[model samples]
Target: MKKTSIETYYELFYRWQRSGLSKAAFADREGISKVSFYAWCKKFETKPDSQDASTGFTRIELAESASQSAVAKISYPSGISVEL
Candidate 1:
């Protein structure tokens, strides 16, 4: 077994994601064990939080509400004089 580093695990994970390869296929191509691939995913994968839905966002759905525009436009009288 080879000594694994945090850098190595992250590198493999990112490569797999970028390649769009299946976990098993990536592990096989990388000359790593299947268990290692799963382990790396467990350690590096972004965990989904159910609580996000309560805040109007969900981990399963990566979206946030756009900023609301509620302020009304300002109107000034022509009699007003201002110096810049």
Candidate 2:
């Protein structure tokens, strides 16, 4: 089998998702081993940088609320902010 690029794997992964087929069925139909398909899924899914953006820790700020309680504020790179 020829080595597949990351973009190809990503395309295949999305195809598999849209096909609504089981991983084993998709792998078999696509002529790839289940292990390899799963590896590609793990590798190309969400990429490292994007994963970091979604799941990585960030600095938090504490602000005084109207009730004199402290509020924890978290900011995301996407210009969204959360207060707790």
Estimate the TM-score of every prediction.
0.52, 0.50
Candidate 2 lDDT score relative to the true structure: 0.73
- The Cα local distance difference test for each model comes to 0.68, 0.73
- In the range 53-74, model 2's lDDT, one tens digit per residue, is 3235444445555786667767
Model 2: number of backbone collisions: 0
Tell me the alpha-carbon RMSD of every candidate.
Answer: 15.6, 9.2
For model 2, what is the error of residue 3's alpha carbon versus the real structure, in angstroms, after optimal superposition? Answer: 0.8
List pairs with backbone clashes in candidate 1: none
lDDT tens digits, residues 1-84, model 1?
678776677778878989988999999999988997898788666545352322444343323447553333333466655432
**Candidate 2: stretches off by over 4 Å:** 45-84
